[model samples]
Target: MEKWKKDYLKGILRDYPKMEDYYLERKEKLLFHTKGTHPHSTTETQNKKMLISISLDRQLINLERNQKVIAQCLENATAETKEIIERLYLSDKQKASLDLVADQVFLSKRQVMRLRDHFFEELAEHLGI
Candidate 1:
C-alpha cells in the first residue's frame, strides 16, 4: 500500500471504537430539530425529510459504512488476529509496540508484525483502499 493509504487504515483501526459512539452522536444531532421548524409538516413529510438529511450526510454515511465493513472483516477473523488487533489498536491503555504484543500473545516479534500486516491488508481490501 501507499504510505498515505497505510496511514489512513491505521487511523481507522485506531478509531474503530470511537467511530461507533461518534456515529450515534452524529445521527442524533441530525435527527434533532427546532420545535416549531416543521410544526405544520405531516409525519410522512418529517420522515422523508429526515431520510433525505441522513442520505445526504456524507460523513455519517462514510462512518456508518466503514463501521459495517470493519465489523464484517472482524466477524470472520481468526482468534489470534482479533487478539493482535485488540491489543495493538483497541486497548484503552497506551498503544503497544510489536515486541510487547508478541510477548503477551506468546509469539515472536516478527510473527506479530506479520499478523498485524496481514490484518491490515485484509482491512484495506475490505475498505477498497
Candidate 2:
C-alpha cells in the first residue's frame, strides 16, 4: 500500500469508534432532546455548568463535521461496498463479524475479507489518496 492510503485508512480507523458513538448519541438525543432543563436557570452555579457544557458541545459539533465528510464518502459508494463498510466498521451497537456479514451476503468468510479490503481501496481512491 502507498503512504497516502495508509494514512487515510489510519485516520478512518482511529476515528471509527468516535463516529459510532456520535450515531448513538444522536439516537439518545432524539429520545431525550426535549427533557433537558430550560435555558434560563438562574443559579450562578448552574450558569457556570452551562458554559462548560457549551465547550463540550462545540467538540461534538466538530466531530459531526468530520462524520459528515465520511458519511458522504460512504453514501457515494456502491451499495455492496457501503453495506460491507458499515457492517465491518461502523455499526454502533456491535461490530459485525466477518462470518455474520458473509452469511448475510451469501459469501464465504474469505470473500467477505477480500471485499473489506476492496472497500478501503475504493474509499481511498474516492478521497484521492
Candidate 3:
C-alpha cells in the first residue's frame, strides 16, 4: 500500500467501530427506489458520498418549491438557517453546508445541525419525500 493509504488505513482501523456504525446508519435506504430501476451500484466509498449528494439534491428541490416553508422554519431561530438559505438562493451557491452556514450565521455547530434537521424534516414531509 502507499504511504498515505497506510496512514489512512491505520486511522480507519483505529476508528473502525465508530466509522462502521456511522456508515451503516447513513447507508440505509440510500439509493432512491423512486425510479423502480436498479440504477447503478456504487461502491461503499461512493455510496456514502452519494447519500450526502442525494440529501443535498432533495434540499435544493425543496427550496425551489417551497421557499416560504424554509423562511417560516427559520423565522424564529437566531437567524441561522435563514441566513444560510438566503446566501444559497440569492446567489448561485447551490447549498451552504451546516458548518459554513453556522459560521456565517454565528450559530454553534449543534444549533446549525438541529435547525437543518428540523427544516429538512418539514421540507421532506411537505414535498412527500
Report the Cα lDDT for residue 15, model 1.
Answer: 83
Query: For candidate 2, lDDT tens digit of each residue in 10-106?
Result: 4675476587687557545543432356545556755566555544565465566557666776777778766777776666646678899888877
Give all candidates' CA lDDT scores. 0.83, 0.66, 0.50
- Model 3 residue 69 lDDT score: 41
Task: Provide the clash count, candidate 3.
Answer: 0
Task: Return the clash pairs for model 1, or none.
Answer: none
lDDT of 1 at 24: 82
- The sequence of per-residue lDDT tens digits that candidate 3 reaches over residues 1-129 is 245543433232233224445444434445543223335644665666665665766534443444444344446544555565455343345455657777887878787667655555554454354
**Which pairs clash in model 3?**
none
How many steric clashes between backbone atoms does each model show? 0, 0, 0
Supply candidate 1's per-residue lDDT for 113: 78
Locate the minimum summed-lDDT window of 10 residues in model 3. 8-17
Ranking by TM-score: 1, 2, 3
RMSD (Cα, Å) of model 1: 2.1
Cand. 1 TM to true fold: 0.85
TM-score of predicted model 3?
0.36
